[model samples]
Target chain A: MAKVYDAIVVGSGMTGGWAAKELTEHGLDTLVLEAGRPITPAVDYVEHVPVWEKRFRGLRDRNAQLANQPIQRECYACDEWSSKFFVDDHENPYTTEPDAPFLWLRGRQVGGRSIMWGRQVYRWSDLDFEANLRDGIAVDWPIRYADLAPWYDHVEEFVGISGEPLGLPQLPDGKFLPPMELNCVERVVREALAKRFGRERVLTIGRVAILTQNHLGRAACHYCGNCERGCVTLSYFNSINSTLPAAQRTGKLTLRPYSVARSLMYDKKRTRVTGVRVVDAQTKHDIEFHGRIIFLCASTLESARLLLLSATPELPNGLANSSGQVGRNLMDHVMGGGARGRIDGNLDKTDTGRRPNGIYVPRFRNLRDGPKSPFLRGYGYQGGGDREHWGRGVDQAGFGADFKRAMRDPGPWHFSLYGFGECLPNHDNYAELDKTKTDAYGIPVLKINCRFGENERAILKDASIAAAEMLAAAGAHDINPFVENNPPGKTIHEMGTARMGRDPKTSVLNGWNQAWDIPNLFITDGACMASSACQNPSITYMALTARAADHAVELLKRREL
Target chain B: MDRRDALRLFSATAALPAVPDLLVLGRRLHERLTARPALRTLDPHQNATVTAVADRILPATDTPGATAARVNEFIDLLLTEWTPQEARARFLAGLADLDARARAAFGKAFVDGGEADQVRLLIVLEDEALRLKEQPGPHPEPFFRTIKYLTMYGYYTSEIGAKQELHFEIIPGRYVPCTPLSAASGPPGGD
Candidate 1:
C-alpha cells in the first residue's frame, strides 16, 4: 500500500504557494502537485540583459507569436520577452461559441500566471464584500471585512506590498511599505482631479508587489522595467521567488512536477475523499496518492472543470458540486475604457529609467460619503507619464542627418488613463466541460460562455468620460477617449466559478474555503471568490489560502478530518 | 582538406551564415542597392520613374526626403523575406496599378511625368487605398494597411525620418514628467 500524506494541494500559483507554505510550516506532510513544467529561478529569466546586447533587436518572429501564443496577444505583456511563460494555444485548445470569444490567457509552468502577473496588489473593501448582499445577487459572502483582516496583515507582511495608506473605504488600506513616487504629468493630473472632483477622486501611486527596500532575502527593484520578462533579482513577488521557497524550507513539502491530476478518488465505504488520481505526463502511467485532505487551487476554470469531470455515483455532477454551482458565476474585471492625450507646455523636463509602477486613482464614486452614480459599482484609474521613444519617432516619419540629431531628444510629454471596472457576479456567465473537445493531455477542455452585462457597460461608458474629463482638467491637448470592443476574460482576472457562501444551495465552498459537502477538501484560488472585486485578487487569494491552511491544520489535530 | 578550408566551405554553403565574408557581402549588397548615388546611377528613365513615385508619396520636408531614407531598398528587402507570397504579389500589382493610373490620367508614364503630375497620380492612389481600407473584404484592407505600415515604418525608423518628423530619445536617463517645451527641443540633458 502507498503511504498516505496528511494533505495534498493542486497547482503552484498564488493560492497554492500560500497553502503549501502554511501547511508545511504547521508540520503537515503536504504533497503539492503542479501540472506544468518546473521553473529554475534567475537562470530562466533573461530580462537583465541590456538592449544593445540583444539579437533580433528584442523583437520575436512571426512563427514564434503564432505558434506559442494566440490568446495571449489580447494582452500587451505577451511580447517576445515573456511569451515563454504563456501556454501555446494549439496544444491546450478550448472551445467557445462563435460570437462569444473568451481570451483565456494562461501560463502553464511551476509558478503559473504568477510568473507574468502585473503585480498590482490592492485590498478589497466592504463595498465589494457587501455588493452581492445589497443587490441580492448570486449569494452573500459568509465572511465580512473583520473576519479576513488579520489574515490580510499576515499575508501582506510576508509579500512586502509597497503602497500608501489612503484610508479610503472603497479601497481599504493594508500593511504597506513606502509607496513609489509619481512622475510630473501624473502629479499634474492628480492635482487637477482633486481640485475638480474633490478629495474623494484622488490619484495615488499603485500598490505593487515589488519590494521598495530589500526584505525577505530578495533585492530591491533596480527599475530595469523588464518585469514582464520575469525579474531575475527576485524584486517582484512571484510565488517561485517567495512563497514556494518558504514552503520548501519547512521540509514537510513533497513538490512533484509534471504530475497532471486527473480526478479525485472517492471511497463509497468511507463516504469521503480517499486521494487524488494523477497521470505521469512523461511516462503516461496512472498513479494514485492518498491524502487526508485535498486543496484545489488549479485556477478558476481549471479547478471547476476538474470537479465537473470527477464523476461518481454519490456525486455524479462533480465532486462536492451538489449545489450545481461548481462552474457557475464566472466573473472577470471589465477593462479597456479610458483616454490618452499629449500634455501641454512641459516638454523640456524628461527623467529616466522605466518606472514599473503607475499612478492609481482609487475607486471613489460608490464609496461611503461619496457622490452617487448611474452604475452600481465603481472603477479605478491607472495612468502613467512618458515621452516618445525610438519606436514612436519611426511611426511619425523623419530621416537624414537633421532627423538623426532630432531623434536624440525626447518628444513632448504624453499621458494615458486606463480604467479597471468592477464586474458583478452573474449566474448566467459560466463554464462547462466540453466533452467534444480535448487538450493535448487528452483531458476534456472547458467551454467558456460569458459576456459583460448592462452594469459593466454603464460603468465602462462613465469611466471613459471620467478619464477624458480628468485629462482636460489637467490641460491636455488632442485628448482621445477610446472604448475597446473586448469580451469577458480579456482582463485575465477570471474569478468566482466556485464561490464561498453562507448557504450550500447557492455556493460550493463555505466561508473557511472548505467544501460544504466534503469536510477534508478546501479551495482557495480565484474560484473561491464570492464576488469579483475591482482590486487585483491575488493578494486576497493569498490571505484566504493562509487562513484556510491554518484552519485545516487545527481540524486535523482535533481528528476532524 | 585542412580544418580552415573545410570550415570556410561549410560556412559558405549555409544559409544566413555567421561567417565574416557572408555578413560583409550581404551588408555591401544592401548598401550598394540603397545608396543615393547608386540610385542616380540607374537607367535614367527607370531612376526617374522610381524617384518620382517615391517622392510623391513622401515629399522632402524639413528633414530628409523619402529617397534619402532608402525606402525603396527597405521595400525590396521586405518583398524578398518579411512578406508572404500573396502579400508580395499584391504589392507588385499595386505598383503596376499606380503606373497605369498615371498614364490614364496624364497621358504619360509615371517615370516620364513631371513632379506635379506624379504628385497628382499619388493623390488618386491614396484615395483608392482609403476606399479599399473601408470596403468589407478579407484581402483589400490588409493589403492597404501593410503598404501604409511599411511606408511609415521604413521612413520613420530611418535616422533623419525619426528625428526630424518626431523627436525620439533612445536613452533618456531619467523620466522628468513635465518640463518647458523649449528645453525638450534641444539635445537631451547630459548629452
Candidate 2:
C-alpha cells in the first residue's frame, strides 16, 4: 500500500502556492505537484540583463516565435528574455471555432503564469458578487463580500499590497503598505477629474503586489521595471519569489516538479477522491499519489479539464459534476477600450526610476447611488503617464547631430487610460473536452467556444467615451478615443467554469469551495469564481485558497474524511 | 530591526553583484583576439556605403554616433538572419539604385563623395520617402526610411548610446515619481 499524505494540491502557481502554504502551516503533510520544471531565481531571472547583451537588442526573435509559440506570442510579456517562460504551441494544443479564435496563453513551469501575471490587485465588493442575482443572468453567487472580507484581510496581510485607501464601496480597500506616488501628469489628471467630476471619478495609484519597503524578510523593489522577466530582489509577488518560499519554510510540505495531473482517483462507495493519477513529464509514465483530501488549483481551464476527464460509471458527465455545470458559463474580462492624449505642461519635470505600477481609475458606472448605465456591470482603467523616449525618433523627420541630441532628452509627457471591462457569464460560452485532439502527454485538450456579447461591447464603448470625456476635461490635446474588439481569454482572467453557488444542482462547488458531490475534494482556484469582476483575479484566488485550506483542515480534524 | 539594517541586509544579498562569468569572458576574449565577426550579407562596397550613409544620417557630435555604434554591422546581421529573402533582395536592389543615382548626380560613388554632397543626396532620399508616404496605394517601405530606422534602433540600443548618450542605468535603486529634469539621472533601459 502506498503511503497517503494529508493533502495534495495539483499545481504550484498562485492559488496552489497559497494552498501549500496554508496546509503545511496548519501542520498537515501537503504534497504539491507541479506540471513543469522547477524555477531557480538566481539562474532563471533576466530582469537585470542589459540590452547590449541580447542578440536582438530587445526586439524579440520573431522567426522563432512564429515557428514555436504562435499563440503564446500574443501576450506582451512573451518577449525576448521572457518567452522561455511561455509554453510551446505545438506541445499544448487546443481548438477553437474557425470564427471564434481564442488565445490560450499558458506558462507550464513551477510558478506557472504567476511569473508573468500583471500584479494589479483589487478587492471585489457586493456589486460583483450580487450582479448575477440582480441581473438574473446566471446562477447567484453563494457568498457575498462579508463572507470573503476576512479572507481578503488574511491574504492581503501576508501578501503585502501597496495601495491607497479610497474608501470606495465597489472596490474595497485592503491591508496595504505605503502607496506608490503618482507622477506629474497623473497628478494633473487626478486633480482635473476631482475638480470636474467631483467624488464620483477619482484617480489613484495602482494597488500592486510589489513592495515599497522590506517585508517578511524579502527585499523591496529596486524599480528595474521588468517584473515579467523575473525579479532578482524577490520584490514582486511571483509564487517562486514569495509563496513557495513560505511553503518550503514549513517542513510539512513536499513539492514535486514535472508531475502533470491526469485525473483524480474516485472511490465510488466512499464518494471521496482517493488520489491523483499523474503523468511523469520526463519519462511519460503513469504514476499515482494518494492523499486524504485533494485540492484542484490547476488554474481555471485545467481544473475543469481534469474533472471532465475523470468521468466514471456513476458520474458519467464528470466527477463532482452532477449539476452538469463543470465546463459551462466560461468568462474572461473584456478589455482594450479607452483613450490617450498628450499632456504638454510637464516638460520641466520627469520621473527617475521605471516604476512598474501605473495609475488606476476605479469603476464609476452604474453605482447603486449613481445614475444607471446601459450595461449591467462596469469597467476600470489602468494606465499611466510617460514622457516619450528615444524611440520617438523613428517618426520625427529631421536626422543629424542636432536630431540625435534632441532624441537624448525626454519628449513631451503623454497620458493614456486603458480600460478593462467586466464580462458577463453566458451559458453558450463554455469549454468541452476535444477528445479528437490530445496534448503531448496524450491527455484530451479543451475546445473553447467563447465570444463577447452585446452588453460587453456596450460597456467597452461607454468606457471609451467616458475616458475621452475625462481627458478632455483635463485639458488634454489630440485626445483619441478608441474601442478594440478583443476576443475572450485575451485578458487571461478566464474563470466561471466550475462556479460556486448555493444550489448544488446549478454549481459544482459550494460556498466553501468544496465540491457538493465529492466530500473530500475542493477547487479553490479561478475555477470556483462565480462571476468575473473587472479587477485582476489572482488575489481573490489566493484568499479563497487560504480560506478553503483552513476549512479542509477543520474537516480533517473532525475525521470527516 | 530598523529600516537601515533591513536595507543593509537586502543590498548585501539582493543587489546581486555584477560578477562576470569567467568561462564566458574567456571565450569572448578569445574571439575578440582572434577575429572580428565576418560580414554575412553586405560586401565591402555595400558595407562602406551603409557606413557612410548612416554616418551622414546621424553624424558624430560631442557624443559618439552611428559609425562608432557599429550600426552597419547590425544592419548586416539583420539582413542576413532577420529579413526575409524578398526583402533582402529589395534592399540590395535599392542599394544599387542609390549608387546609380549618386554616380548620375556627383559623377562618383556615394562612399567617395564629400560630406556636403552626401548630405544633399540624403535630403533627396528623405524627400522621396515623404513623397511615397503621401500616396494612397500599398507600397513597400522606402529604403531610406528602412535604413534610417535601423540606424536609430541599432545606435540607441548600443552600449555607448544607452550608457553615455541616454545615461540608462541598469539598476535604479529608488523611484522618484516627480523629480526635476536636472536631478534625475536618465531613462532606464528596456522600458
Candidate 3:
C-alpha cells in the first residue's frame, strides 16, 4: 500500500518548491513529485567548462539537435553546456496553430525552468490586480495588493531578492537586499531620463533573484555571468539550490523524481481531491498517492492539461471544472523584439567585472493615474550596454592576422532594450487536451492556441518607438528601432490558464488559489495568474504559493479540508 | 513579390547534394564510441590545404596561430557532423576548385607548391572570396571565404586565442562600473 502524505505537490519547480517548503515547515508530511530526471548541481552543472574543451566547441551538435530538439534549440540557454536541462521536443510535444506559432518551451526536470530562469524578479501592484475590473474585460481578481503585500514580504525574506526601492504605487517597492550598481552608460541614461522627463521614466538596475551578498548561508554572485548554467555557489535562487534544500532541512519533505502526474483523482463523497494518479517515468507503472490536500504547481499549460485530462461523467469538462473555466483565459507575456542602438559616450569607461544583470526601463505608458495612451497596457525594458568583443568578429568585415588583432580590442558600445509587455487575458487564447495527441507516458498533451492581438501590436510599436526616443534623449547614436514580431511563447512566461476570480462561474480558482468547487485542491503556479503583469512572474508565483500553502495548512489543522 | 520569386526559383533548384552523400558511418560510429570527435570529412590532401590556408589567414604571432590550434580538425568535424548535406557538398567542391586553382597558377597541387607561391594564390583567392560579400548560393561560395571564416571562428574561440591573446578573468569578484581601457585589458567575449 502507498503511504499517504498530508499534502502532495505535483511538480518540483518554482511554486512547487515554495509549497513543499511552506507545507513541510508547518509540520505537514509533504511529498513533492517531479516529472523529469534528478539533477545533481555538482555533477550536472558545466558553468566553469570552457568552450574549447567541448566536442563541438560551443557550436553544439546540430545534426543531433535537429533529430531530438527542433523547438527547444531556439532558446539562448539551450547551448551545448545546458541543453540537457531543457526538454527534448521529441518525448514531449504540444500542438500550435500553423499560422499562429506558439513556441512552448518546457524543461521537465526536478528544478524545471527554475534552473534555467532569467532570474529577473519584480512586484505587481493594484494596477495589475484591478486591471480586469477597471477595463471590464475579464472578471476581477478576488484578491488585491493589500492581501498579497505581506505575503510578498514573507517570500522575499526567504528568497533574498536584491532590488532598489522605488516608492511608486503602481510598482510597489519590495523587501530588498542592497541593489546592484548600474554601469556608466546606464547611469548616464538614468540622469538623462530624469533631466528630460523627470520621474516619469526611471531606469534602475534589473531587480534579480541573484544574491548580491551572503544571504542564508548562500554565497554572493562571483560576477562570472554564468548563472544560467546552474549556479554552484548557490548565488542564484533556483529550486534545487534554495527552496528544495530549505524543504529538505525541515525533515518532512519527500521528493520523488521521475513521477509524471497524470491527473488528480477526485472523490465524489469527499467533494475534494483524494489522491493523485501518477506514472513512474522509468517503470511506466501507474501509482496512486493519497493526500488530504493537493497542490498543482505543474507550470501553466501542463497543469491545465492535467485538469482537462481528469474528465469524468460527473465533470465532463474536467476535474473541479464545474465552471468550465479550467483551460480558458490562457495568457503569456507579449515579448520578442525591442529597440537598441550605439551609445557614443562612455567609450573610455569599461566595466571591471561581468555583471549578470542589466538596466530596467520600467513601464511608463497606459498609466492608471496619469495620462492615457493608445495601448491598453504597458511594457518594461530589460537591456544593457556592452562594447563589442571577439563575438563581433563574426560580423566584422575582413580576415587575416590584422583582423584577428583588431577583433581582440573592444569595438563600439551598443545598447539594446528588449521589452516584455503585458499580455491581457483573452478567453479565446486557451489550452485543451488534444483528442489524438498523447505524450510518451500515454497522457494527453496540451493543444495550445494563443496569439498577440491588436493591443499587443500597439504595445510593441509604442515600446520600440519609446526605446529609441529614450536613447535619443540620452544622446545615443545610430538608433535602429523596429517592432520585433516574435511568435508567442518565446518569452517562456506562460500564465493564466486556471486563473483566480471573484465569481465561481467565470473562473476555476479562488483568491487563495484554491479550487472553488474542490476545497482541498490548490494551483499556485503561473496557472493562478489572473492577468500577465508587465513584470516578471516567478517571484509573484512564489509569494502566491507561500500564501496558499499557509492557508491550506491552517485549513488542515481545523480539519476543514 | 520579387523576393518570393527569388525564393521560388531557389526552391525549384533542389537543395540536392553535388555529390553522393559522403556517409563515413564506420568513422562516425568509432568517434561516438570513443567520445572524442574525429575528423570525418576531409582526407589528407584536403586537410593539408585547409591548414596551409588557415595559417596565412591568422598566422602565428607571439600567440599561437590557426594551424597550431588545429582549425582544420575543428572545421572537418563541423563540416562532417554539423553542416547541412547541401553545404557539405558545396564545401567539398570548393576544396577541389581551390586545388585546381593552385594547379592553374603553378604546375602542381596547393600542398606541393612553395610557401611563397601558396601565399600568392591565397591572396588572389581571398580577393575573389571577399568580393561575394553576403550573397550565398545559386553561385558557388568562394573557397577562401569558407576556410578563412571557419579558421577565424575556431582560432578566436580556442584556448590559445581567448586566454593567451584575449584576457578572460574567470572570477571577477566585484562590479566596478567604469575602468579605463588601459586597466580593462581584455576582449569582451569570455566564452
Per-structure clash totals for the candidates: 20, 0, 0
Candidate 3: docking tier: acceptable
DockQ of 1: 0.17
Candidate 1: interface RMSD in Å? 6.6
- In terms of DockQ, the best-performing candidate is 2
lDDT (Cα) of model 1: 0.77
Alpha-carbon runs more than 4 Å astray in model 2: B1-35, B188-190
Error of 1 at A431 (Å): 1.0
Candidate 1 deviant stretches above 4 angstroms: A49-59, A390-398, B1-86, B90-191
Docking class for candidate 1: incorrect
TM-score per candidate, in order? 0.82, 0.94, 0.92
For each candidate, the DockQ is 0.17, 0.47, 0.38
What's the residue-level lDDT of A536 in candidate 2? Answer: 90
Ranking by lDDT: 2, 3, 1
| Residue-by-residue lDDT tens digits, candidate 3, A1-561 | 678899999999899999999999999999999999999998998777878888888888788788998888888888898899888897898888788788888898999999899999889988888888988887899999999999999989888888899887778898899999887777877898899999898888889998989999899888878788888899989999989998999999999999999988998887888888999999999998999899999999889988888888878899868887777787878875477888886666777677888988788887877999987979999998888776666544555678767776787888888888999899899888887888899988888888889998888888888888988988889898878778878889989889899889888899999999899999999998889889999999999999999999889888899
Score candidate 3 by DockQ.
0.38
lDDT assessment of candidate 2: 0.89
- Across residues B1-191, which tens digit of lDDT does each residue of candidate 3 receive? 24565555446445646753335534553454444334588887888888888887788877889987888888998888788988888888888887898899998898888878888888787766666765766666566767777887798778887678777766777777777877885644356
Q: Report the Cα lDDT for residue A99, model 3.
A: 86
